[model samples]
Target: MADLAHGKPGAGAALSGGHGAASRRDFLTIAGNAIAAVGAACVAWPFIDSMNPSADVLAAGAPVDIDLSHVQPGQQIVVLWRSRPIFIVNRTPDLLKTLQDTKDISLLSDPDSDVLQQPGYAKNWNRSIQPQYLVLVGICTHLGCIPSFMPQANSVSPGWLGGYFCPCHGSRYDLSGRVYSGVPAPYNLPVPPYRFVSKTVIRIGENPPDGGDFSLDSIEQI
Candidate 1:
């Protein structure tokens, strides 16, 4: 004759079980929603960032101006374009002559510079319009490390006329940034597409108006 429905323990147990079930369902729903939101945020961030201009884009194809007046003779300056360092070395008259005379043409990998290391206008012995002003990309062809400009003729191994030295390995380049025969570098350091906007102002990334395989527009979009 016990009151089955009204028993205290039975009623309490039934209520507790129902509450626990509801709580678990709520937790699972909330957690799932949070996880989905996080995933969506991750996907959206990249798309948002891409809309803004990147450093490479801003600098890639833009003409970089440098003042030649401040650049001293026999010294060099490093500038950044599309995250790559470009070297502007003002060679002494003696250094220019030495680069032209001492290095044997037969020994070079690209003797006539047939490769596309430089713009069409820069395909010459010095690889620049003015012999004293040498503008070149600072990366080493061997492994892409920035080469230290060694102005002294003997800074590197003996019989080292003068040029840049890549400390990462023993790669050496002439003042024109042309690689030596036995070095690890497969080719010469690239002469970034550039033009002299004026006597003192030089642009690093853009090509001249005259047409070629590569153009200013290509670099500007970087």
Candidate 2:
């Protein structure tokens, strides 16, 4: 496969980060409410470097560990990391195959993840460290709108293969988070710096074991 950042001939975009302490309490509350509005529970974050993630910690780009033991295939859970929605999808075998098919990926704008939208380890056909799990920033590349998870086949349109649908502007991304060609969204969904801590645990806001010096800020868009 061609390199998204190097082999691609065009210039790619740059990815788009603070906080305080009473001030710290207020920030956490706001962060908690932001998550609540999205229907996600604010669980205590256990980062590899820190036992507990305070509002100040998350605001400062600390990692967040999420338990995926209960997340079944085809189910996705949203977790807040660095105050942004991180989408974790437990992909089924069928979805994995779809992401690898040449015909399917040909319809995407950046099938090879050549735009540096993801970490070095996640620049694959699946756009993830593991083929069965997909981690991405829930915000759309265009206008930063949160894209709705549309996993069911044909749920958004006739013959839809299943993925995310940005209701805000009709931008569509395949299950692998690759944007469809000709869409208003200029690039694929930004994949955060993440690593699988265990079989059923993921640590977001951190680099993968083999991913050296890769940061989310290096992505083409966020």
Candidate 3:
């Protein structure tokens, strides 16, 4: 999630660069904290002391839970899951429309998300389990640079419809992280296994309750 409402809110999430925790004592300390509102464009995630987790939380391969209740609509917050940057956005209704709009889809390389790398609930028009919240691995498929969250229309180029831009190679993606045709990126951004533990709390590095064997390793790229 990037610049929403064309303003930078300096968004922050609960854990920055945490690998995952093997024990609750290390990871559950901030279960009640909300993801601070972040906005504007070209998302830059500098660690904040209040939002950062302790070093022990970096233990690998356990579920990472985040409180997303305070993430304002249109705000995008980035958190590290298994040391991979995860983009979580509270997509507003208007943003949802852009994902569904044909005019916008026409510019994408994979509008239908037909790529097998996107399995489970992500292989759809919106590329998410729900229409409102979007979760994606925030690395550019072209060469692994973090794509800037430019949600403002025309923020990166003429006719831009609010999505991600990988400045490293000029690759573009839609709000749903679908790569654009003629861009250097070939596939949509990968969606990690995640599910809502509660209405506002999201658990990353694990699947939703109904999720069946949707392994992250099955996805060839991050």
- Show where candidate 2 strays beyond 4 Å: 1-60
Q: Which residue ranges in model 1 land beyond 4 Å of their true spot?
A: 1-61, 211-222
Model 1 worst lDDT run, 10 consecutive residues = 213-222
Winner by TM-score: 2
lDDT of 2 by residue, 1-222 (tens): 222443455533221002322344455667888878665332423333366666776577778889988899899999887778999999999887777767767788888888988888888889898888899999999999999999888899887888989999999999989999988999999988888899888888788667887877677778
Worst ten in a row by lDDT for model 3: 33-42
- lDDT by residue for model 1 over 100-183, one digit each (tens)? 663455566676667667777888988887787998878887887899988786778676678878889878778888777887
Give the per-residue lDDT digits (tens) of candidate 3, residues 1-222: 321322445443323324654434334534433232243221445545536665666467577998998889999999988778999998999988888787777777888887755657777878888878899999998888999999998788788879999989999888888999998888889988888888889888778777776866787676
TM-score of each: 0.68, 0.72, 0.72
For residue 125, give model 3's deviation from the true position in Å: 1.6
lDDT of 2: 0.82
Please say which candidate is ahead in lDDT: 1 or 2: 2
Candidate 1's displacement at residue 173, Å, is 0.8
The TM-score obtained by model 1 is 0.68
Give candidate 3's root-mean-square deviation (CA, Å): 23.2
Shift in Å, residue 187, candidate 2: 0.4
lDDT of each: 0.75, 0.82, 0.79
